[model samples]
Target: MRGIPLQKTLWHLGVLWRKSPLALSPEARTGLWKMSAPASTFDIFLSHTWHTPGKWKILSLFFQSGWRFSFLGWFVGASLMLLASTHKLLPLFIPYRSNFDGATISCGAASRCLLGSLLGHGLGLLLSPYAPSACARRPLCFLDVASIHQTDRELMERGIYSIGGFLHVSKELQVLWSAPYLSRLWCIFELAAYRTANPSGRVVLSPLFVECGACICILGAYFAAFLFVFALPLQHFGIYVVYVVGLLPIYVLMHLLRRNILAKHQLFEGLRFFTLAEARCESDFDHDFIHTAIRAWYGSAEAFTAYVQGSLRQELLASKPTTIPLRYLVLLVGVPFGLSLDFLAALIAREAPMEWLLTEFLAGCLGFNLCWFFGSVQIALFLCDRFAAPWRGGLFDYLQTLVLFLIFFGVYFLGSLMASTSNLWHALAVASASLLFAIVTLVCRRAAVGS
Candidate 1:
């Protein structure tokens, strides 16, 4: 096989992000290529569709690049929120009972508390910064838009033909997937070539919609936390009042949750049914080239198709039902956990006895925050496997919505009941049971995935 020519350059991922492919000056490109270490090999083969919006691509890349840091940032922010609230450094804006007597915080104060938490989160992210120097040390990627010649036809053809060589040398393939990605002939070629070239190499399937869904889920969690803070003071006014007040936000959250799950289902279905024949190419010459390459690599087009439809399908579905990373889950769970710190601060400000504080701690930390929030998310995702079918958009959809809402409501009610009880033994029992439930659910899911 003809290898990638020395003139074909690998781009620094940071440089590519900074001076985007569309606007790279010749001198800058030459400088970046010179800056790249081990010019013959690539760290990543970026498989993406040119048709995807640049903004979406950038966002996807952002998440891909700094996901670890993002998780750490969230953790730090949550910790800081708790620390500040415990020390009474930040004002207690969320209401809490004073010796089981009801007292409400002003709405303005609550809004400020929310705003402070957001700012703290943003600050935390900034603190866990990705320095330019650090980014420069990241993988050297073969991004076609930058790596391949765009304006020069001869060089472009050579680069296109040399993609197989690129894949052979690259360590991993990172697919910046969108709805149109699978349907693109070039995208399919890249995927097939990379897998064929390096069977043991990592192929990260990052659906663009996953990040969008994660953001929506995070926002929904924050909204739920906000409502929980509001409902805390109202618990003294009968649990029914709290439930009635929460219905609207609960409905909103359910809608968002269902929408996210459905989007994931659509993506999964697309992957399951993907076929090379259905993929489109802009040029007949390119199509022929890809076909010839696949035939050469895999013996025949039919064999390559089988590999994608069989092995690739199984690999993708292995993490099915929910492909969300654990880090994102931590971030999701952190929102409620962090917000619950306000309740702690409120108790401290009220000078509650140590026993009462200890009960609140166990109830909030173990019972409500960890057990309720984490377990509930897992249950929703697990249930999505069964419920995420074709949307009939009638009574069925409403029924699905109701089912989801009730599941969430039931989980919330259990956690609330645990928190409301003043008995330490009750809190401990609820916490232990909740923890056991979470552990069992996780173990079963892993077993199912393994099977």
Candidate 2:
């Protein structure tokens, strides 16, 4: 709404009020800064694990002091967190550990009561280089730093420069590592927002924040409401813990692997007929024979029909072959991650007292799965538009993503009716993941056509 001069003035005003943030009083600052957009991905990310820096010194001290548990804590915690943030949802499992009381948890390992805490700790470590410790102390301020790089030097030179000092040397790692860390940071921020704000808080937390909070709240309420809810007749506490802890790593690894690695690639090249190759195919067969060979490759009636139909459409214009970008991975991973986190937060909170019947717990789990599936669809849509075409990938396509929802419901309906509800929506969600892959294919193919 404001012109350059006005925006410049806002920046200047922000500079004048930078260090002594609480001085302006919260309301007036929020009111003035409302002119800016909400926190960007970067903002959320930094907040997620900003605590590591402060803890970093303490953690480093542990190592220096040669504490056995501290070393084990950092090592195991970092590895697990690296694994967990990628995949949020986990399957149920039972484990046996010599030290642990009963069956231990594992997505595939022993239960970690310290899983989230250690995750938070490890995340804090991974994030320590890019995220300043001071920021953790004043997390809400990230909303103001949404996209700021304006005072980087000043922040490091004068402000509590714990992480920033390291960042001075390795800007790339500092910048690159920020993504996943930022997300975790945002989760913490949401957690803080939930704690700090009133029940009637008008700020309106995003759906995940709202869902997670509500789920956590409802979960506790359910234990109080139903006598049988937490009065487990056939206890599977160990199995339950394993299931939950196992989930956290799956969440983390999925993001790291999918977003950081698998989802990114360079463009693929080469198309026949469209561009003449200097070297031609060395087949010495006749044109008719070659035609026969080509037909046989796509011999299926459906394949032939699709090929014919696709060939005729002017809309199917070819461009340069492109690779899926990290952004797509972010969508593929981030969307599902947020949704599943919401679901898990709900599920855990619900089962806290451990009294619910197995049947009800199962149903609750399934329903929450459905919720995550929907939320992920939103993320998938965002990725589609973000990677391929911004306009085409809008609310409409995202809304249309219900094809996936229906697909899962169809599977779940068929599955849960049988002996086990385990594979019920699982297949559909997997299929949807494939569908997302296909969308990526369509996008990259489109990019290829354009190029």
Candidate 3:
């Protein structure tokens, strides 16, 4: 079997991140294939589509492989937040003119200052403790574009015919699913062949939309941070205006969530009604070859189709729904949590009074930033489940979007109110309530999964 190192595969794919496999020159692809190590078995068989953007495949792989990229993301985000807090980078250009109770308050600058110092402390804590490394051995993956021949027709045909051999040897089949994956003949053939060859091997479905949803959550968090840093200075105009401005990010998030929901619905529906006859291939010769192979292996095309419709459908559906996994959630929550560190840093930097520190740390950082943002993501996940149902119509989707916006706005409004208050008890109350809501939503989701 032709196998490429995980690191090299990522490098080559990164080079072609914006382009499809067709964009690679035949000579370059042939060279990549030749450079691959010859192995009797592969650790992973990567099944993907050429039609989808390459970046999606890369992101899916990173998400599936491990937490290396996630940790890197947190490190980079925390570093940036620290810099912004210290005014070493990303200075708020907006003039601060808000004055309350005989004191001029530069909320924007103060927020940044606090964010930077808190990140600094966090970095210290992260480094000061000695923790064992959690890295795992990287798997050798058989990627079609690199493993199969691209230039010579004879070699290409041989490679295509030998795909079953590779799949048989692979311990795991990783399907990087996109919208077009189910309708493609070759994708279905690969999936069916792998299952037939290794009945006990793992089939890991890493849908592209789930990654997109996680990305949307992270982006929304950053957008919220932007509004907090810039809009807080506008409190002189009225807090309600800041709330209105906050709607922009929430609206964008809802729009993306709608797309994610549609994709997820299509995915499950496709699995339910998969038909080999309807699957398309670019070449009739390739189609005939696959059909012949299937008949030879399973005695008839109908039997193979039954296998796909019965066993494969159940297996794929048995995996988790479109809800973002816990790891991705951690990555998502880290965004605002990292930003909230600024509040702590600011408190320490100015040597503020104990009551001020308590208010900002408890109310601003934990309650408003961490707990409120966590609740917002839970709401998004819940809305995703609601809209994904087939019974929902376009009109209802629009109404739900509106409802989601209002719900997010209300949460933000309440968080802002609590964070602005000087009472530590109010901060504790808001934090407790939001945390409880997040936990309850999570529990209900788990129960739904169980049932």
Candidate 4:
């Protein structure tokens, strides 16, 4: 009788346990609900979230399917642009805060952006030929504006003293040499200190004048595009906008080419170097290392007669002038306006309306004129260098430059005369005029080199 009851009780307990597979506690049920709830917005990547390890695998699989065939196939470019604008790519090797007492001039604005770009693109300019990327863990940059402590007199003094060491060890020294740089006593000291420390070191000069011109050109292009988009009649605004959009990449290419031309043709404009201690009075800049060292050491003008002499020589020996090809000149002249002579000619022929062709011609004229102005400026700078002999430093150079202008003017006058009231001829004439000038300049340069 006792065995029969015990077997019956065990069967009942087994049946109840099978009915409730998991007899969870109330607290356990609540904890599970909380864990399974939706994640916060912060945890999502472009609205995809992973609450657990398995969910991460699911997300990855989903991403793999759609990664390649996306909008514009430029997702990587967009990502990079975003990263660059945020300055996430430029890791701060040395963290520094602005210590200037009056105003905060940190590299957050255009200066910072340009510096960051130079760091990435122009690292070779700053680095020695044999220098290894990882030989020094830290960036060997001396941001004088950003590095020193402003309030502490003792710290500032120490920073000033170490300026020489910084200049001495630096492979390249870049001087902005703007009005503010000239006015600041400390900034002048830094320049002087660099010369004192390294008589033979490479110094890169950032001429504000040329940089400003480039900036102005960029701003003007943007403004023109903007104005065209809004100021035009709404009937064909979309078409004009498309044209503007097409011109943007070309403008960038043109700007890069122009900069390369300037760098290749003229590095030291309105400046000079002298062989002996003495130089002409009107030379814009002269390098005298002994005088520089003396002035830096003593902070007095007693050791030097003239601050601006042609005695300062460029560290690098001048190389033979390389002849730029015709195709490059054509691109530099035409690319900025998205100009295709064949396309324009075909369009004019197909349209065959006086108003339309005239309009196009006028537009082409404007583009060609602007290109001519810029091209002439570049050629002028190039020629200015050729005429910048030590003996021809002062009034002689000024007179020679006038002659250069006369030559350009004469060419333009002759081209205009040839165009002479014919519409097609006029358009061709303007472009040929500018092209002719560039060609002649190049020819002259090549001849000079040959001699």
Candidate 5:
């Protein structure tokens, strides 16, 4: 009885279980969570030194074993999108390059919106398990209630991340922006409503605000760069005149600003060392979600820093397995480079005088960005962190990754089903179809971990 899992012993076996170190204390179990990670995600941290050494050995083994899945997932997703576009029956989502939906403007709003969310949510899911925080561990309580006191930002900076805290708000902004301009006014009310229901006092938001602002500013610059692409259809002299006057100068201004903020990813990792090294009792100061969220924003730079500083940390991780250098080499080459190629091709094509056939391609990319802005996979974020324990154990966990693949495939599936049936004026389903992926992403949290 002492060793049995709580659920199995209490409900299924109809017996009382005894105390075990691995069992989750009622404190961690308390709260509104429906789907939960295996208690082990937390339990390992609490283990005493005598048993920690073996656990550390097992972790390195696990990291080595799981590298394939990350690589394979990336390839499969890219290939699926490729086949979906090439096969005629499937709907191809092309981006539009029009500076204005109706009339010319100075920037590519849709692309900016897409990139904002892409960076925010994209990195969250991609790096979750291997990173210090799991995507699922969203909520943190203030003062521990037992300890009985703390301030708002103080509480926030502790690690009680709401599933939506890190990336959801910005993605939601995408939804707000995707709306018709008039509809955009309603977003303030939407924020007020969300805060009212979600409880701003209990939740944290520092990094979220900072990250969202950084994303807006950074992508805002990238959007400005596309202006050079937008005026391409004009006479060469006219385009050059516009590029010099309206585009190139502005883009340079923006890029320099973003380059400054992004350049220092390595410097921020030191905060983690200081915090971990300094932590003591359940003192309320160190565990703020707002602080942690802000800290999480640096991705590769942070990883690079951590790799460089190995063995010197104030608090060394029990399982500090080194990642294979090739994995990161793949990323440094793959992500931003691949995205840049797509961006350059679009930028060049948009600048080139229009070929009618190519018009649809640009049109599709713009449309996808609009769809992407409002769409989120926070639930996927939840599952990635939520069921992480059950994940390594067996069938149910594997099914979860399948959930993302299903939605990934379904976007093309539903779009193909609807788009092939009619003409653009009548049968165009890509907007709603892309949204279907977003909705599936929303629902899958419940399917696996519930939103």
Candidate 6:
């Protein structure tokens, strides 16, 4: 019996010694443990909040309708194009209202309402002749939290990388810039992602559709006043013409300067006005990639500039050369004022002679269109520079701005005179200048990359 007990104790002590912490070094012990699982990968990533339950409903509706989903910008551009061509007053003024209650799940969340409303409008517009069909095929809608499997940590980690990828490849970005959207940390990241993807401008502002249309319509009212309300002579009406047509370019130019200031100061990237208020209110998420990106952006002006240049250089070398979107080119560049040509003619035609009418119309159209294009080129160049290097400095940026200003101003100054000549020669002058400016812009962008 004593021998048996001693043998059992010795065996127990041996087992304890084998399992003791002193048996192996810390590194060796860690080496014996299993590692964490590698993150899962996916082709697409959607980024959004878990609180937005309505998004799932919207996603269901999208699939059930047998219609394809695309980015919001393509649809908005097509919608605007169609609305403009139809010469309809309804689409411009009428707000697109959705059947579903956007706020049903999320109280006071305006983005939910906007998402539903815009999708509804886009679905209706897709049936139209002018809708962008290319966007509909193999439609991929990335709705943040819905797209990622939250229960799986690996999937979520991989989803983060996919966010940047989807943003870069998406045909359009429809942003619902509500208070919640601006306040959320993820929303700002979405914006930065889209801006980097389409630096030449496919980033559509969902709210701007009606607002810009209304602004144009209001401008039309002023034109109508000159036509019917209080008749003014052609010469006097030209004052209003200059004021109206000129305001757009000036606004755009001033906007460029303001945005450049923001980007330079590292306050925000791309379109700052849309998210400024919300960004200020955004909750601190220390571990977020978005914050890391922001920190990298703020590290040092020179360091950030070099990093941007490196990124842009890599992008430029790898892909096709960057070209401005035709939609943005037409919309923001030269089309809005061109469309106003007929209305302008109508306003002054009633009060002026045929010669004066033709001259003013032609000249106004040419001048404004040229101005719009000039302003657009300036905008594009500035964006290119900003994208290439946010904190870019030295003589190049200044020289580029000064050169652009002088060239456009000279063209405008000459175009205004040629317009008043009543020979329609101003169109030719504007055409030549615009072509030259465009060529210069393309060349300059290339040069930026080369340097």
Q: Scored by Cα lDDT, where does model 3 land? A: 0.68
Top model by TM-score, which number? 3
Best by lDDT: 3
lDDT string for model 1 (1-451, tens) is 1222211221233334444555766666554434333357777787877666665555455554555556656666556666666666766654444333243323212323344455554444333324454433456667665576656668778878888888988887877777788889988898888887887887877777666556666777777677666665555567567657667666766666566656666666777776778989889999998888888888987787788878886775564434556666776776766665666656665667677667767777667777776777777656654575636776778677777778866876776666665666776777787787778767776765566
Once superposed on the true structure, which residue ranges of model 5 sit more than 4 Å away at CA?
A: 1-229, 241-451
The candidate, 1 or 3, that scores higher on lDDT is 3
Per-residue lDDT of model 4, residues 275-324, tens digit only? 12332222233234334554657565533223323233233212332333
Per-residue lDDT of candidate 5, residues 1-451 (tens digit): 0011112211212211122223445543332122222221111011111112222222222222233443444454434433333333232133434332244312121222223223433333334334332323322211111111122344333423332332222212111111121122122222222333333222111111122223333343344435633554577588778755674443333333323323122222432342322322233442353234324542433542353255322222221111112332232222322233243244343443343223333224322432332232233223333332333435554454455435533453343343222123322355466566556654553444211
Candidate lDDT (C-alpha), each: 0.65, 0.30, 0.68, 0.36, 0.31, 0.39
Clashes of 3: 6
Could you tell me the C-alpha RMSD of candidate 1 in Å? 5.4
Sort by TM-score, best first: what order?
3, 1, 6, 4, 5, 2
lDDT of 6 by residue, 1-451 (tens): 0001111111222221133223546553343222211223222223333223333323222322222222343345434543443343322221111111121111110112122223433454234222344533333445443343344567656755667666665555555322244455566566656656556534433321222222232233234322321222235677577656654554345334433333222322332333222343223552355657745544643443444345532432242222222233332332234333433323332344444445445445544444534444554345534543423566565554545545545654554454443344554455455556656755675555455
In terms of TM-score, which candidate is stronger, 5 or 6? 6
TM-score of 1: 0.80
RMSD of each: 5.4, 22.8, 5.1, 27.2, 22.7, 20.9
- For model 3, residues 1-451, the per-residue Cα lDDT tens digits are 5777665555533553455657777677677677577778888898988888887766655455534445554566566665555553554444433222345344434455334433443343233212223444667788877777778879778888898888988999988889999888899889878978988899988788887787677667666776766665555667668867786666868767766768877887788777778888999998898888788878887887787778777787677745678777866666677666665555444445666667666766777677776766776677666665534667776676777667766766776665676566776776787677668767886776555
Model 2 Cα lDDT, one tens digit per residue, 1-451: 1101111222322342234233555554444444434331121212223322322222222222222232334445534543453243433232211111232222222123224323433343334323334433212223222223223445322422222221222111101111122223223223222322322222211111111222222222222212221222225786466545543443333222222221112111111122111212224342234334334545643443344234412211231112222322221222222222322333343332233223223333333233333333334323432343222444544333333334433543343343122342443454444445446545654554355
**In candidate 2, residue 263 scores what lDDT?**
18
Worst 10 residues of 2 by lDDT: 267-276
Q: Give the worst 10-residue stretch by lDDT in candidate 1.
A: 1-10
| CA displacement after TM-score superposition, residue 179 of candidate 1 (Å) | 2.6
